[model samples]
Target: MASFPTETHRFQSFDGVELAWTEMGPGNEGARPVVLIHGYFSTAEVNWIKYGHAAKLATKGLRVIMPDLRGHGQSAKPHDPASYPRDVLMQDGLALIAHLGLADYDLGGYSLGARTIVRMLANGAAPRRVVLAGMGLDGLTHTQGRGRYFHRVLTNLGSFERGTPEWLTEAFLKTTKGDPEALLRILDTFVDTPRDAIAAIAQPTLVVSGVEDFDNGQAHEVADLIPNGTYREIPGNHMSAVTRPELGDAIADFLAA
Candidate 1:
């Protein structure tokens, strides 16, 4: 539960849309840089900073870069359909790396953020190391399944019953103060990444997920897809896993190794 100092900055993405990103850990030039993207419907604060993951990574002498993905946090949330083209999140991530002039760095993300990492890799964004947390082969290959589920959740926000998966997602969305219209557009931005592209990823990758998190399919199967991928399981389900210190520990260990 330790709190770490963080700095927030904004930059224009590929489409001139202003996006916000936060930085934590050592500021010195020698500190290794790692870009950590948050999950869908969650901001950098809720996903990384709020749960002490950023702090944990920072303590290990890493410069953690966490971006509040478009339509999620402090970034621009345009409801216009045109604002969210296919694979927009991946483009924004690539743009962020270019804007920062990161020639060599690491990348990590959870859930939707993990999906974004896969998209970035497929689209030729090369980071030295990568961590795809809370994702699986099915999640990457069957993007429409999860997208359709989220689309339903957003379109019928108040109709879900208590304790249901949709209700939990909606509750989390409410807590994040997410814009439904904008998020619906984000859902439209998703496109399936072929298994061959995933198989071609050459970076050392870690496929870590919660033991109970089957929401995105089997994590080990994702590890099997990548050319140089490893699988690790942490405590908690999809919703609770990110909050656990083991998640940060696993990521830091992998990155440090």
Candidate 2:
């Protein structure tokens, strides 16, 4: 069994939206920070902290910051899709980085968070190193496709406790609290980056994927693209993959390398 610190705090993005984020580990003396971004519909504390990841990484002598993206966790939910654009997400991330005055750090993201990292790197906000789990830039194509697609699929699937696993359903319920129409509009605004985005990321990158869930073969493609990229496969489906401790170990090792 694993547990995490309950301490919580709030920060604001450039747009004035109040964002909720959690920081764990020691006071981060001279250690480079590791920013962890979660997938859509998931919060920082529940996703990353519950698995003892923050504590584990902290013990490894690193600082960790996990933030709840807009419309998730305790952050403000803006009804405007324009506000949630991919660049906006990137800015939100960089804003956190700049606010903390961290000159250099490592970055990691799962699912939607990974996609955001891709956008961040594409926009020239590259970190020293990056670890992307449960996603690849290729999946961003779907994100760029009609945002209405997410609205259609999710709305049509409306609250299916059956067939869907308990944990995933629970995860969905947390971030879908906004007006469905608003979320749809927001998602619609997202346009996935073309292959050029991957080509632009010059940092050392590590791509991780689960046994299940293959989205556009982006993970492998990403590994093949970056000058210094490596690929690793973890056991379990997309939802269960990142929650495992072994996955954290692999990430810690990669960052150390």
Candidate 3:
């Protein structure tokens, strides 16, 4: 697949933290906009652009806005624990949308990004549509479970035996050159979303997940919870699924429709 042109820009969030976001596809007036947020410890480049997801969406003639979450990628990584208040990521996403002047755009996120989208919706973000990828009901209601697991992984960096889940996560972290201190603080910022909040989401939502991915629970359950939600299963697991073209294809098709 041909690479799509991308532009990276920075903006200040609600707390004056500088965050970075990338843009793909046509910049012309009246182009439909879609904001794609990356997962935990992952950047917009790794989760979206690196695997051609952004490009695929761009090919559909949609403006793809990919943001590198705070403490990841080109965004400022503050080590201060106080800087990462509850729902800071959601606030950052909201700020990015405002900064870009996007009012009628679509929103999507994978894993942590997906959870963030749920928080945004519960907090009254009015996206025209939403795509929750690699997320499930447990992910929203039982966030502390995953947060604790990641805390262990981050707190105990090099002690995990080879072939263990922690080892694999640590390996991926190294690839991303993530800051454990900042990310550890990020883990504290996670907040659970009630089932009532999930059901209250009014926008049409697509809950798409990898067939083998259960890292965040069952995607179909998430779909079932939303008033206007549908589910789709694609190839691969949580890690491998993002590398598949099918992930991008599903998202582009949904947003275009």
Candidate number achieving the greatest lDDT relative to the actual structure: 1
**Residues 1-257 of candidate 2: C-alpha lDDT, one tens digit per residue:** 23334467787788888888888766658766899998766778766887776777776777788988777777777777667764677788888887777778999998878887887777667589998888865576557542443555557654555555543554465544534444554564455777766766778888888867574345777778767788888887776786888778878888876
Each prediction's RMSD to truth: 1.1, 3.1, 0.9
| Model 3 stretches astray by more than 4 angstroms | none
Can you write out model 1's per-residue Cα lDDT over 49-124, one digit (the tens) per residue?
8878888888888999999999989999998888899999999999999999998899999999999999999998
lDDT of 3 by residue, 77-114 (tens): 99988789999999998889888888899999999999
Better of 1 and 3 by lDDT: 1
Clashing pairs in 3: none
TM-score of each: 0.97, 0.86, 0.98
Residue pairs whose backbone atoms clash in candidate 2 = 144-192, 147-188
Q: What C-alpha lDDT values do all the predictions have?
A: 0.93, 0.73, 0.92
> In model 3, how large is the Cα lDDT of residue 42?
91
- Sorted by lDDT (best first), the order is 1, 3, 2
Superposed model 1: Cα runs more than 4 Å off: 1-3
The TM-score obtained by model 1 is 0.97
Greater-TM-score candidate between 2 and 3: 3
Candidate 1 residue 118 Cα shift, in angstroms, is: 0.8
Worst 10 residues of 1 by lDDT: 1-10
By descending TM-score, how would the candidates be arranged? Answer: 3, 1, 2
